[model samples]
Target: MHNLTSDLALALEVADAADAVSLAGFNARSFTVERKADKSEVTEIDRATETA
Candidate 1:
């Protein structure tokens, strides 16, 4: 149906936007890994990607 096609297109657009934001942040980060007190690895890229 036309409505179904429209919905799919909108979903695809949103996915594309998210990917752009995530990848942009990923590319801007250093690869240095830092460990937290919780023994978890955290990077600026991770937070940026999640926010994206």
Candidate 2:
């Protein structure tokens, strides 16, 4: 149980880091969602968000 709590905390920290990067990029750019021929939204922000 103690180990489980520690692992959960670590996971939360990683999530926080990812969110910080994503938010920073999102704020730095004007992200526009464009629909493809298949009707899917795509943007450079999406790649940045995932890579971050």
| Top-lDDT candidate index | 2
Each candidate's TM vs. the true structure?
0.52, 0.52
Residue 50, candidate 2: C-alpha displacement in angstroms: 5.3
CA lDDT, every model vs. true structure:
0.73, 0.76
Worst 10 residues of 1 by lDDT: 43-52
Question: How many angstroms is residue 31 displaced in model 1 relative to the true structure, after the best TM-score fit?
Answer: 10
**Lowest summed-lDDT stretch of 10 residues in model 2?**
43-52
Residue 24 alpha-carbon offset, candidate 1, angstroms: 0.3
lDDT of 2 by residue, 2-52 (tens): 689889998888788778877876888877777878998877766665665
Model 1 agreement with the true structure over 1-52: per-residue lDDT tens digits: 3699889998888778778876776677645667889999987665555555
